[model samples]
Target: MPDPAANLASAMAGAYNAGDMERVILLAAQAGDEADEGILALRGLAEQATGRYDHAVETFRQLAHQQPEVSAYWNNLGVACRLRGDADAAEQALSTARSVAPHDAEVLYNLGLVYIQQRRWPLAREILLDAVDCSPGFVEARLQAAYACYVCADNIGQEAMLAGAVNWPAQPAEQALILAAMLSTQGDLDAALHTLARARLPATPEDERLRLRIAAQRAVLYERSNHLDLARQELKLLPLAALDALPDDASQARAEGWRAHAALAMRAGTWADAAALYRRVLALRVDAEARASAAFGLAASCDRLGRHGDAWQALDAAHAAQLEIAREVVPELLAPDSQPLQVAEVDRAAHARWRPLVAPSSRQSPVFVVGFPRSGTTLLEQMLDAHPEFRSMDERAFIHELTERMEQVGQRYPDELANLGGTEVEQLRATYYRMVGRVLPDLGQHRLVDKNPLNMLCLPMIMRLFPQARIVLCLRHPCDVLLSCSMQSFRSPAFMVLCSSLQRLARGYVTAFEQWFRQVEVFAPRVLEWRYESVVEDLDRHLTELAAFLEVADASPMARFADHARTKRFISTPSYAQVTQGIHPGAVNRWHGYREQFEPVLPLLQPMIDRLGYSR
Candidate 1:
């Protein structure tokens, strides 16, 4: 006859396998102190399955105590602790599990989850990257890493992680849909559309839902790529109303389609249609980010329809939603400590302290376009980019990246700029050009027009490295700038955190310009101020001046900027749609429409307004 203990273990194992968790627990309880490691382990797993996390944690803790070397016991304890809302305990157990099995992917992934649960995004992405390296087919780990990248608004990081999926042998339809959307965000519309096509496999309802998602994303991409006809065709196929027709989880896809339609409607001057579409998206069960974006779109639509009160309310909601996300997910953006690169809260004293220790190099310096956000920098960039003599890269962090290298060596940027030697200067300058080459390969005969709006804060650094570089200052109505900045749903942390409120945004603008004004006094570099209202009033006049400033062969090419824009894969700014519409006074003096909302911020913005020569 079989041993009694062996027989009982076999019975309990059968019960556990059959998902008879209560019976498994009962048998384990009856065995009590007599239960072996196997019985205890099975019972602990059953507790976890039944959501008895506290009981599971205790059982796993006991098992771990009995067999301290067993990685599974420690891992189980970690999972149970995590599910029970004890991140500290989960981390402790997971760290123990990691120590026992250093290369264990499951332990690593769980550790990543602990950080993710706490909203420590950067660390979560790094740990999740470790998990992916430890094991193949850890697709969940990869997806989580991509999500972590997105949370911090690291577009480059997100693109790189999602693109790495190509190394995998195959991906399920559901996974493919997400990866495609990631590519689209990085301005690779063709690649995104291609990936979407491959995701249309006839497998299951989830696959069918995945196809629906693919179509939704494709519609948005089509519109971005300037294939409006196709975008309209794709949108007409969607707009799922019935609960059963669309998955409850298809909120993401549905929102994308709705927002695309809203954008299209706005472009067509159908404010009512745009407002309705935005309301449809707002009604969806989506996250804070999507909600923020929909609200902003609604505000814009309302503004066009002369619903100033509703527009103001929508903007308030949008900013609140974005502020919530930034505060919760990336608190460092609000008041950074160590990020000397992106931690650019520069002021007058800081600007005055800078002295150019690095002598100007003979190497050709790219022309710099500087302004605050929503100040017509993109409009200028596109017009300049339309010229055959100039090329513009997407808004880049190369300046931040360059300063990061300085921070890496325990040197602060402007503070240390006064002390740099020829060797260090050559190294930093080389690094800057190396980054430019990586993006555009060869400028050839064309001059690179570097357009990062906030690079105004880095003027001392720019002037120090390339004193002879010509800079274009795009000036707009201060009130309009603050209003537009508040209305946008920018992904960049600097904008998200700083533009959270009109007061904060005004303070930031004043501070940035104070830094700029001081740099102008100190450096006395060649500068041209292009007032935005003046440019819009006479596009031809500004185009001529721009061509003259850059020494372009023909100003006529700049006139076709709208046509040039449509051929681009995508425009990477909020003005993407507006740029294609040609020169229009729609945004000029738009702050007047929201004058009531601007009243509070007027005192803060008055000095800049008067200085910029805009009427009060």
Candidate 2:
């Protein structure tokens, strides 16, 4: 009498080993009544290898159910979910596998994939670190973690992560990619290009795509390196034909090319051209990010042409897209602003603990010039940056990143704060500084001026981190700021989608302003609000006032702010072009031309507008 369970397992494994998964399925069906854990796992593996994804998933589910304590089964389930593009399920299964088998390197690697797919770069870094810890020889996992760090612009950690890889495989293309990434880090973009050139395939049309990617990377690096002509040439090398490819891997390649074209067009001040490119992209990808970006571009072109109605329409679209994405990503944060006080709430509630971070010091706190997007924040930063003692970094988006982390840690409200004792708060503060330290390595005589507009909402946190930090909030007439936001195209999906509508634009401004008002009430004399109109209307008077706030010497170049448009270091913000070309009076009250279209949002904002001394 053949042992039925062993017989079934042997048959399935034999069929799977031979790559005859169809036979394996038949053997599994015959062994249905006799199938044991080994047989069931074998069937699942066979199904997965043959590309019968659903069947594989079902088989894995059943096997995991039958052997609830088997860690490998859960890990296999996670792999299947990942293959089927279910990131949430993959995370759950990988998490379960971790609990069951704490030392599983494969499970950790799979968990890292889920984080990467969800754009949780920091978590991916941590998980990959764990994977390498579990298995020091896991070279692929180390490489991926290094790549994630590179993309997130965490350059300080990248070399350290890459250094841990025990075995880095060197396929031709992969070798070139590694070299390109390394060159990019060192700011040797031309050398990066030379390395990427090695990736070119001699005869395949796909080689064009490889070339385009190389060119795109070169363009980005050159732009950052301030070689504008070289950047333009690299962008020009990207094939337009790639943008219209059929829906295959090549289609995605085309999409990437078109996206880059839209960005370059905006940078080159070819608004209409950028608008057209965005339209083509939105036709293929109808998401908030694409549509909003395109609409913003279109609005900018229309505004430039003095076509107010069209600009209004485009602006409205972009705003709407951004709100929708924000709500989806953080529902509790949007829901009437009331929710369970979790980690986030607790962090906010423990403001008293932050006093130590802000203790008085003769060493002046950094200057944070914040305002609504498309206002004079960037310009102001440039002027301030010209001073020898000020280092202006544009729109670091640090607070926004922290907000995302808060959500991840289930910090819905500050009531969650009571649960976090002094130790936890200290841990949280250390983590915050760690992230900031990576970006702002040198905090010497030069004060760090991070001019991220959205930091308006996180004034409490900013005060905690840099107690001596001076807050310089920029203000423009509601009409101009709203109009600028509507008209200016953006690369970030968050802005493109939500600020598309006049009503939404107005709502966002009101929301941000209300938050700002709350902060001023708490901080009192710590914050200095500047009106954009006043600054431009009397540059010298305002520049002197600003210098005084910073305690800068009277002779600092910032006192000669008009020269800042050319002398300041380059920053990648939406207002880059406007600041570079010197002050333009065009943006002021351009909203008046489209008054009829914007009236719907005016009622909600009328009081603020009036208070700011602007009127219809």
Candidate 3:
């Protein structure tokens, strides 16, 4: 007593399971109005597999509408929509699916893919991790979560994911490349190369395209790790003369080859060569970060070649690309004006609440190096770090973490600092030192120098925790600082937004310094104003004076600062390259050349200029 529809659906299901997709689709067409949900679902899957995405989407949409409560139907609809390049529709459908079946790994995985497609790294990372939790054997879900981690710069998360992938032998070529990239970023060069080796095993001579890509990536890893000679050897394998019109992934690898070559040229200080290769990278279809880096590199090379006009053009392109990333990552803070800083403008009320306490502890306080970014903080950090007695993690956000903790506890930072008692302050101090130790395992007897430029915004909180913390206030020409901030590619979302334009950068600078001055005039924390120009003018005298200020008896190590800088594997500042060479007054007055660019933003920085003892 089998029903006709039931029998037909059973046949279609048999055909679908037996790999006869064409027959499954044909049988569904013949069934027509008599087709059951099973037959139609099989037909839709077959159509999707057979490159009939439109038909598949239509079938899935019909099923989804017919059974609104079915999570599978909704998930299928989302997958179909995603395949058809409708991200918005896919997200909507997958969100519905996720709601219908909160524990569905398939639904969560699809939604995570959609978020990754939209460059929403945090969401992608979270959702994909959820998928893995729902189904621990979801290898692809875990791998994708790791990818999202790499993009968001969550190195610890990426490393954990990589560590979990002990079954590396099962990894496909594409997955191997991703793993290699993640490994390489964490500075495990040999392991990355080993992964690439696995990807190229049982070699096929005819398909050496993948091999070339492997060589290019290897070159990039070497170059980025500062192994120039090894990078050169790999670069020789790449035909950098022309990139093929390949698909996105293949094309991107080729583009990266040119970029790696360009970065090497930049390191070698061959401006023309670097400029040419960067132009090649720009011509290719690169991701936003790569495009922005190529553009900035082009600008720097052109600037070095005495091509200020070309440099400005490239800088405009670079900043535009950077702002696009900011728009996606931090849309709320992406206003072209300086609105984000206005919230933190220390008014008279906030400053009036600051009553400095003379606190003492057995543990030595970190020397707080604060300033508007690009005010020569990097240079100061490098010089100080060269001394055997001084150590720095170079731009850790300890203060920012403290600010976030305050906000998380329903207390606004700076404004709420006045409410903290001695007990809370001691707890906070313990937390700060614990966080520092996590990054820097052994402080021993060496003084830790916390050199974060944006720490200017958290000076009040810093003083609260370490009432007698020695502050080295690095100062530069306001115009120069603003210009430098505008030029650099900062990692912080708020900073990226603030530096999107010269006007915004100037406004942030003015307000930050204004806040600092207000706190200083009242609280008067132990501070030294080290003018950047004066430091450049007298490196020896200034270094000695700085050593004296920090109470370091031996100023000899400070004299060899440039040599120490050269030995550093990496410096996390735009001035990294500059520190490798001897001190020069080169960047001191370079802002005058861009007087025209600064003309519009000059008045915004005038009061600060006067405050810092700068005539212009």
Candidate 4:
């Protein structure tokens, strides 16, 4: 009997006060009810608040469609769309809202968040900055802007952005990650470790997400500083529960922790431990890339353990995984030839392309001591690292990985200076930078000494990347190299690929190294061939010559080579424990101990032995 207009108004008022949605719906739908825009908005807001996302979305979409001038309705619709994972619809709705409400701080903030999800870093940065300008106190906008800087690897921008966020009323989780990142950038390893140790975050809390991130970041920093002890300790503290919470997410904290743990073990020369960690990570997340890495680690471990069969299995797994990944993107890029690729042939092509790239960046006049496994590459690297100014990045596979990625994309050689398009070149360059950046950053003062013997195949690639990169080819008697390689039970892919016969081993080396040397002769004139015998014969003389060639001014450290070797880290190769001790001349001709065993390979290595001028 009551007037319908008054009844509707009373119903809305009661719904607003008591929050009873059924009565409001009934009253609003009654005949003769005076339904207005304000009443509709109230209904929409109530529906949204009560978790009726579908109904609320429909109501807001209709209202916005009917009254295109109402920016708030469109903005609300965008929020609903984004909540429903309809980013495309959300973007359109948000764009419309921005057109009508260009200066609205709330809408700008929302737009910035959408851009963040879309990975439009530049646009996100701009929108976030605009949001901050409109409302300087908006914490979420500033936080997202800081994250954008992180994505760009803009350390300074990250610092400035995070400084602003830290001053805001930040959640504890955010505070932990920001502090960890700042500490890491500044290279305060121990302090960062301690900070991570005391970190306390609430489980089942939103901020806890940031806490998980902080743990992972801190683990990376620890690994970088070569503090394997701390890295392993800290990684164990991460929330495994969070990984379960994100079962569908590939970038889970648990998976990252496994990688960090494996890296720590790798750095600490614990191949078995590293392999175990990699396997655990692969088990949880069967990603191709991770599987390749895991297989490689397992192979390396098995080789170190002198388990030849196990090592081969691991290597085969790695090769299969790598080939599979390569095939996905480039089916035509064939696998490395079954018959061991002649190193010289591969090197010739690699050097021609790589020389120019390496030449300009060879600031420290690096000495690359390369040869087959057990052929004294590690010893050469250690002797080189003994010199104070020459910093040795021992056996880093950055160039190999970089080249493999390039080869996957059909880029043949690094030194040839091919004229690929900007986008194609950019993709290759990005991968290379990422790979190398993983190991070296701001390596200004010291001469870079990379001794990845396997990289002997990609000397041409290295030369192209670092036209200034000096190559130091480490040579030993073929019989000596082969004998040492076979007896040592070497890691797969490195030494095991020679197929166990001293003959195969010698042939593999001859094929690989001959290709490497031939390519160098033509493509690189800055190379210095060093005999392992000469190094052990007169450590100081060889080192001084090396120091001068590498442009390392300080040769006094050569006098303390014994002391220098004692303090170095990550010596896992066969020469590890040996190089860590005083230089002994015993290994120089130890192959004589098994001369009869070396007869078969002796013939295959005759040419290299003659070329390298080694006495039989």
Candidate 5:
């Protein structure tokens, strides 16, 4: 006869495989004192599969305690804890599992899942990559890695991850859809459509749902590619009624389809249709992010349809929803004290204290284009980029990166600049060059144009780094700047929170301009003030002057900057659409249309307006 313990273990294994959790637990109990590790493990797994996560955690914890060397027991414990939403405990258990069995793909995958739950996306992607490397067939780990890459905005990495995972596990259509979205976001619309075309869908119900998702993504790709009619046709095939008829489980996919339709309508300039579709999406009661996005889309539609009041109200709602979500996820960033507006009285003596120690190098210095956001910086950069001798990198945080590097060396900003030795200054300068080189590698004898509006705050640092660098300051009417900033949807949490209110926008404008004025006073001659109104009203004259400032004679190519902007594959700025359309005088004094809205903030902004020499 077979041994009783062996017989019991075999029965438990059969029950576990059959998903008979009660029978598996009963069989394990019957084994009593003779229950081996396998019997206990089966019971633990049954408890986990049946959603008795606390029971499973206790069982796995006991097993891990008894067999301290067994990685499987620790891994199971970690999985149960993760399911219970105890990321800290799960991470501890999984890390211990990894320490026991360093090469175990299951352990690595579980640890990566824990990181994902904690929102440590980079770390999650790194460990998940390791998991896939150890076990190439690990489809789940590969998918998780792709999602992490998407969150980190690593489009290339996301595409690569999905490409590697696509052939595995019967080529999941979900992964294909994600790959297409990543490609589209990276401005590779043709490749995105091709990816969707090559995706294989089986006859299963799940595959049917995936088919809808694929169609939705395809429509978005068409819209982004400026094929509005094709996008509309694709959307018509997957109508909102068809999406609504889907099962409750497909609610997310249904909502996504509606959003895609709205985006297509928006692109087609059918504002009413877009508004209706966005309203339907909102009625689905999706998550805060989706709701915020829909509200923003609705606001845009209303704005296009000449419903200013409704547009402003919708924008307010969108901002509120986004701020609520941001508060939960990144409370520190949304904190009132996070970005304190500098309103200290200008100290001429303090400004004069930090003298430029580094002399102007004979080497071609970089051009810094900075001003308040929405003040024609992108237009200027695009025009400058049109010149053959100039290569302008758009809106990079090189100054912030340099500040962080400076802090890393145990020094504060302007205060520490005075004490830095020649070698330290050169090292900091080299660090900046390395950062710049990463974005623009072949800067051989060409002038580098770095355009970041917020660099106004870091003027002292910039002046110290490159004493001869040309600083082009873009200026606009303070009211127009405030209105434009308030209307646009900024990705930065700080900007979103700050610009949400007209009062805050005015205060921020005042603070930023005060700092800028002080910096201009400190660093005269190097700073070139260029007005947005002047540029738009007299493009030819301004372009000529701008070209002259760069020591480039002909301004002919600069006048056709919009034609060049249209050819650019990627532009990471809010002015992407505006720059492509070329210079428009309509934006100059456009604030006059919303004088009623400006009345509340006029007191705060009028001083700056007059100071900037704009006729009120």
Candidate 6:
């Protein structure tokens, strides 16, 4: 007679393949003490299919323990653990499977899935790419890799993945949407629209939800392309009533629809409508980024309605939510009191060793615009950008990038600058030029304007790199600057956390300005102290002076800067809306409206206020 265990395993496999999970489990149990690895594997897979993850995990764990060298057993265990929402255990099990079968495509794919579940996008992308390379027919792994690229904002990688995925059998609608989003981000609106149109959404509820999400994303693309009317039209396709009728399980789709509507409302200056819709968005259990975005929109609505107190409270919530998300993304950099103190210390040491080069290099030196946030840097940059010969980069971290590059190459900034041989210095300078060239290419006969506000902390580094660089230090009333900073939502958690409280905002401002004053003493006469009030009150006068300082012959374009600003795209600052609308003198003393709120921080800001020539 045939072996009982062998016959039972064969029956179980046939039953499992025929979707008879119950029969598979029963046959598995009938094997009893004679149950071999094949029978146990069948039982585990049946349990997993039937949503009995606990039983599946136990079965796979026992099988893997009995046959420690079996990659399939470990892979099944990881899959079961992942199904049960135990990412840590899943990662461990999958890691073991990877080691046991280093070239196993299935094992690699499972481990990459676990990493994606853990939000380890970079590692997941690497592993998933390996899985695709090991087995080019792995459609699931390719899609997962595309998702990783989307999360990491690796547009080129995402495009490559989509190109391969399109050739796969039975292409997924989700993949099409991902391709559309990536194309939209790259400013290929026509291609995005085409990709989205080709999406084959099924009649299933899941696909319906995807369809609604695609509509929302298309609206965002239109908005980014400066077609606000078309953006609103796209959003209108998803009926508000239909979105509201979605069940709790479809909360994500509902949230997206509401957020899209709210964005249109905000753009149209319908503050009340935006406020109501954003409130609905916040009520849903959305991701942290979505919640933070809603909170920010609500704050903007409140501010426009003259609800200053409500606006501040909403802004605080938004900043806290964003900071929490930032902590998850960069735990090391989110430590309290780390960034401010680090910058202060580094700049102090760097300034101490500051020296002019023997002769300024022939390369075009960037015009550095540095100051505290909300201090009219954007205004100055936009004015300069309107000129034919000036090209401004909106709020980049060139200095920060250079410093990190120095550390990567076995050299510390400032301290290592003094020890650098001529060749090393040239190499470092070349690296800086290469970075700028990549970001702001085609700078034909135009002076480069680097316009990061927090570059106040990098003054010494700027001086060392480009000794002939013209530095414009934009100044505003300390109280106004602190108030505006506290009100605005910053992308940097370090800055957001520092300005979260009135007291901390005041103290941070003082620390930054103190550094600025010291840097001025170290590199005097090269710095132009441009006041925001002066720029607003006497635009022509200040523009003429600014032109003369930059050695430009004409200041006519500066007068019509707002007109030019409105026509420009890709404004990457909080002041984008404000600058496009033209200068508002009402922003001059906004602190007066929040005087009671400013009371806790006034003493800290008083010295800076006086030093900056602002009257109490």
TM-score of candidate 3 against the unseen true structure:
0.82
Query: What is candidate 4's local distance difference test score?
Result: 0.63
Off by over 4 Å in 6: 1-59, 70-76, 95-203, 330-341, 344-363
| lDDT digits (tens) for residues 1-616 of candidate 3 | 8788887788888998899999989989988876678887999999988888889999999999999999998999899988999899999999999999999988999999999888887889889889878987887787888888776655556666666464556565667778888766544567788888778433553245566667878887776655678888987878665345444556566667777778778878899999998898898777888888889889888877878778878888988888887676667777554375533544666767766555754137888888988998888898888989889876677787787788889988777788877778888888888777765779878888999887877776777787767889999988878767766776555666787778877887877887788767766778888898897777778877777777878888877878888676556567866777767677877777678878898888788789799978
Taking all chains together, each candidate's TM-score versus the true structure is 0.84, 0.69, 0.82, 0.47, 0.79, 0.80
Stretches of candidate 1 exceeding 4 Å from the true structure: 1-62, 80-89, 99-106, 129-143, 159-178, 199-208, 242-257, 332-363, 442-445
Q: TM-score of the candidate numbered 2?
A: 0.69
Residue-level lDDT of model 2, residues 22-126, one tens digit each, is 898888888766677777788888788878778778888887788778989999998898888888988898899899998889889889888878867667877
lDDT of each: 0.79, 0.66, 0.78, 0.63, 0.78, 0.78
Candidate 4 vs 5: which has more TM-score: 5
Q: Which candidate, 5 or 6, has the higher TM-score?
A: 6
**Candidate 4 per-residue C-alpha lDDT over 46-69 given as tens digits, one digit per residue, 9 for 90 to 100:** 777677778778878988988999
Tens digit of per-residue lDDT, candidate 6, span 1-616? 8887778888988999899999999998898877888888899999999999999999999998999898989999999999999999999998999899988999999998888788776788889889878987787777787777666544445655665343445445777776666555443466677777778888787887888888887787666555688888898788898897788888888988888888788789899999999889889888876777788888878877888888778877887786675564445645555543346334455555644355353236888888888999999999999998898866667677677678878877656766665566667678776756755778777888999888888765676677788888899998988878876766554665576577877877888888778767766527788999888798888888998889889999877878888676546567766777677898998888788788887887888888889987
Residue-level lDDT for 569 in candidate 4: 42
Ranking by TM-score: 1, 3, 6, 5, 2, 4
What TM-score would candidate 5 get against the native?
0.79
Question: In candidate 6, residue 261 scores what lDDT?
Answer: 85
Model 4 weakest 10-residue run by lDDT = 350-359
Q: Identify the superior model by TM-score, candidate 3 or candidate 4.
A: 3
The ten-residue window of minimal lDDT in model 3 covers 200-209
TM-score of 6: 0.80
What's the true lDDT of residue 486 in model 3? 67
Question: What residue pairs are clashing in model 5?
Answer: none
| Candidate 2 ranges beyond 4 A from true positions | 1-69, 81-99, 102-105, 108-207, 217-226, 241-249, 266-270, 285-288, 316-324, 332-358, 397-436, 458-469, 487-500, 514-522, 559-570
Question: Which stretch of 10 consecutive residues in model 1 shows the poorest summed lDDT?
Answer: 337-346
Instruction: Estimate, for each residue in 1-616, the C-alpha lDDT of model 5 and write its tens digit.
Output: 7788888888888888888998998777887766788888998999998899998999999999999899999999999999988999999999999999998999999999899788776688788888878987777777777777766544445655665342444445776776666655545566667778888787788876787888888776665554557777888779777898899878667877988988877766789998998888788867766778788888878877888888788878888876765554346656555553323222457656664575655236788898899998999999989988888866677777677667777787767776677788888878878767755778877888889898887887777778787888999988889878877766555666777678878888888888888766766637778999888778898888887777787989888898888777557676776788888887877677668888988888888888889867
Q: Candidate 1, after superposition: displacement of residue 216 in Å? A: 1.9
